[model samples]
Target: MRFSVMDLKVGDRTGSDVFNWNGLLVVSANTVLNADDIDKLQRHDIDYVDIMLRYDGKSPEEKPAAAIPQENETARTYEEAVGGIKLLFQQMLQEGKISKELVDQSFAPLANHIEQEKDVVSLLLTLNNKDDYTYQHSVQVGMISYYIAKWMGKSEEEAVFVGKAGYLHDIGKSRIDNNLLQKPGRLTADEFSQVKRHTEYGYEMIMKSQLPEPIALVALQHHERLDGSGYPNALRSQDIHPFSKIVAVADIYSAMISNRVYQQKQDLLRVLKELHQLSFGKLDAKITQVFIRHMIPNFIGKKVLLNTGESGIIIMTHPTDFFRPLIQINNQFINLSDHHELEIQEIYMR
Candidate 1:
């Protein structure tokens, strides 16, 4: 029976393969739909789907197993999770560790928001709060890592797990002194060294909290660069785990794009360009390229304000020009790659 996506619930099996308007198959036939699957359908504007109905003519398991909360419920999920995470960090500072249960309580709700979010470009621009830098960074990095993992073709379970690791990758920073963490100026040699140890502290804390070894490893190794320039163990390229490398990319992007007390946020596009350059030897080349490849496409359908005071809607992005795109304005299509003087100043995200 065809049912509105709004009415479909978790455990509602798809009776047929569901494809988006773009003709991309998102969910397979006979697949048991989860919150993520259902939300993806709605985001794609898929209104009616063939839901498997039992012989009695009702969808199996008439009651949904807590389908991703409706709009009213989900709007509060991210803010509430951030508040809970703030408390978790404070608790970690006091006790030196936080239990797996606590970690789950603070972060699990965000899976709904994370799964539903496709506009990451706007997400980064809008959600960042400089005052709550670390807390917000944790959430953004987790979300970014989750998307990166999925883009790299990781399974849902694996991607979510990687997201969780990214979320806690900086938990050790809670143990550091507030003065050092919030300092507005460059740290002294001694102070910088102390800050770097947060990796070990984070690893120990996560292990003590009974999270997995991989989670602890991410905390420890996320700072480890492809070269031996990073802190803690300084494990180079082949020695580092891919999960840690993934979080590292997420961490750098989040930290750089966010407004820090010491470092002002750069333009979103400029940061991606930097990431492209960093991919050479400092970061994983393949991983960084994958991020740029996927992220560049987000411009295809956005309304943007150019530095030249012109406004246009992005018609399509170019293959090699990562930030430039073909835009439509005043009935004319402008290929940004050919217009070097035109720069995107603002993305009017709705």
Candidate 2:
């Protein structure tokens, strides 16, 4: 079967791919669908249907092979796992004993789930739904760090360890008071000091647990800068572990993109710009370049409205100048770097 984006109405059977009553993706096989699942699909504006047929255990010869609807299974599963991790942290804060069984039971499955789908962008985007900043930030860092590790050609085991370190990097923030953590104004010197304590607190918390030594080390060192400007410990570039360096970049990127109670979410392009600027002193220049070149490109698709009232789809991205990209509007290629008049005013994801 050929893949076609067609408006599907309820009860329409285009082929083996049956359009649900609500025009969501559904297979004609004997499986049950749920209300939440349908609602989630609708939220993403997946109203078009595409059908794919298999013959002799292979996809049928079709010119336009169906574009598979991006599955949120990996995302959903990762979110659930992060939720469990959050719960464990909450329990720990309450002085409740963290059982090794619970930690293994929760993280082991999450590790396996992340391993199945190596696409880190989808994983990070999926985990962004969490309303809580700490939990969402943790998952984002994990996914981003995992992607960085993979890009560096690290082994699967090393990548997973990097991911685990990222996930637990901010566990010490659990001890910080909610008022200070969620404050909307600039923090006072004392408040900033308290905020800085999270690194040490997270390190101590992880040290007490059954997690591996490298994971705990990452929690402590993620804040340390290459120029000895980072917090908890002013370790220089050589003093910092490679995993910590990876986590540091991921953590800063996620924090910059995320909307906190005190601060609005920074523009995606602007955040990348800031990261690039800071790469010289704080972040690893090579990894920062990799993140900007590879990871940042994934968030830039979908249509955008230019400041000149021209709208278009982002066609190309620049590694060094992330804020600028070539746009296709009305069948014309407008390069933002050259056409300074045409600036992206807003992005429309549909």
Best by lDDT: 1
- lDDT of prediction 2: 0.67
Candidate 2 has its poorest 10 consecutive residues by lDDT at 28-37
Candidate 1, pairs of clashing residues: none
User: Which candidate gets the maximum TM-score versus the true structure?
Assistant: 1
* True-vs-predicted CA distance for residue 135, candidate 2, Å: 0.9
The lDDT of each candidate is 0.78, 0.67
Cα RMSD for candidates in order: 5.8, 9.6
lDDT of 1 by residue, 75-102 (tens): 4676776786788788788887887787
Question: Candidate 1's C-alpha lDDT?
Answer: 0.78
Q: Tens-digit lDDT track for model 2 on 178-230?
A: 88888879999999999999888877777787667788889899999999999
Q: Which stretches of candidate 1 lie over 4 Å from their true place?
A: 1-74
Clashes of 2: 1
